[model samples]
Target: MPYALTCTLHLRRQVQLLSILTVFSVIKAGHVTREGEVRWQLFNECSQGMLQTYLGRVNTRGFSDRHCLTEFHVEADFYGAIRLQHAQSRKYLCFNKRQRITLRFNGDSERCYFYERINHSGYSELESAWQPRLFLGFNGRGRFQSPDTYHVKRRCFYWLKFVRYVPEEELHHCEIRKPVDQHVRLEHTNMAHNALRNSLLNQIRATHDGPYKHQDQENRNGTYSL
Candidate 1:
């Protein structure tokens, strides 16, 4: 009976493994359904607790002077989200400190280079420091070949607002405003002034109170010097 139970457990494990393999295969195949087809929950198993994600499609339009634009909106509490949709039927979506998303076509050699960088340097390097230049490779026809320039589009959208935290005693007197460019500069300047004023007040407090008391007495008797 124990042996039979063990065999049943093993069979169940094999079925689970097969299910996982099938999902992985679908992801690697890069298959696309009709235009309106939606694949909800397709990535449920793969994306749970995943820090990054990607989506892409092929570029139907040939290389032209026109530019492609993508917009993203994210709240401040969340790290960030980047979506890269290429004309070449390629799509990449990721979320991280400096998230990156790129799409490339089959037989594209440069895609390998990008994958290496994404793995080694990570998303921060890709968004901030790495400025990937568009390169156009030519075919033997002397024609400007190498799938016209992949119209690349990128945007950084943040929606988190910061609230000034004031002590309970100071809250009544403190004023807060929507931080504008000028307001920020003014606040910084005011902070510096306040710091300097506090430093001067501390110095005065450190001095012996005797001299200050003596001066006050003299002033009361109308004998104090300017």
Candidate 2:
């Protein structure tokens, strides 16, 4: 092939790749960490498995071992900031004036909260904006209270662990996702991309050829086909 033809093919391929990238970006923006609501399951590595809503339930004011029934899916902001709220009770976990984190039944004020993974491990500790030293954890007894003191027996035991949670709706949005699902999705996307490219190129060719055909016919006969 001539150099000019080779260059034309390369330019066309680049444009096609750019268009595919643009489409993927628009489709994926909704699923990134930036958009929609993100959730994390508060898992305790040593104590009760899951961290749940420790609302003013009967004998469950602080923290409990109940799994899903404890309620309140966690909501996190950018930079790993988080707030736990019970759906039915409409209560939010807020830091109180006592320098401890507590469940507030009703409040509109936004408090500062940040969480970080410990040693790049799955286990994480949630930190509060007001109290710098203390973390969100259960005390000597398994309760969901951020006491000022650390656990004397095992300091690492009480530190909270987190797993980025996906809601049921989100699950439906992506069925084939697992730890290795991203690579699969990319492969599937790339494999199917050629068909999409062919369709787009066909549409472009039809659009470009129409006007030129009409102009050529007019020049030959000095008349417009109505």
- Displacement of the residue 66 alpha carbon in candidate 1, Å: 18
For residues 41-130, what per-residue lDDT tens digits would candidate 2 score against the true structure? 454554555545533541122243333434444555555455666543446767677665566656444543544434223235666644
Instruction: Put down candidate 1 lDDT per residue, 1-226, tens digits, no spaces.
Output: 3777667656655653353233222332577322211111110111111111223322222212222212111111122212232211323322222222233333222232221012111111122122343222222221222222323211111011111212234322312244569888999999999999998777666244533445666678889645
Report how far off residue 200 is in candidate 2 (Å). 84
- Model 2 compared with the native: what TM-score? 0.44
> Ten consecutive residues with minimal summed lDDT in candidate 1?
37-46
lDDT of model 2, residue 211: 38
Residue 139 of candidate 2: its Cα lDDT?
Answer: 40
TM-score of each: 0.19, 0.44
Clashing residue pairs, backbone N/CA/C < 3 A, model 2:
62-144, 63-144
| RMSD each, Å | 21.0, 26.8
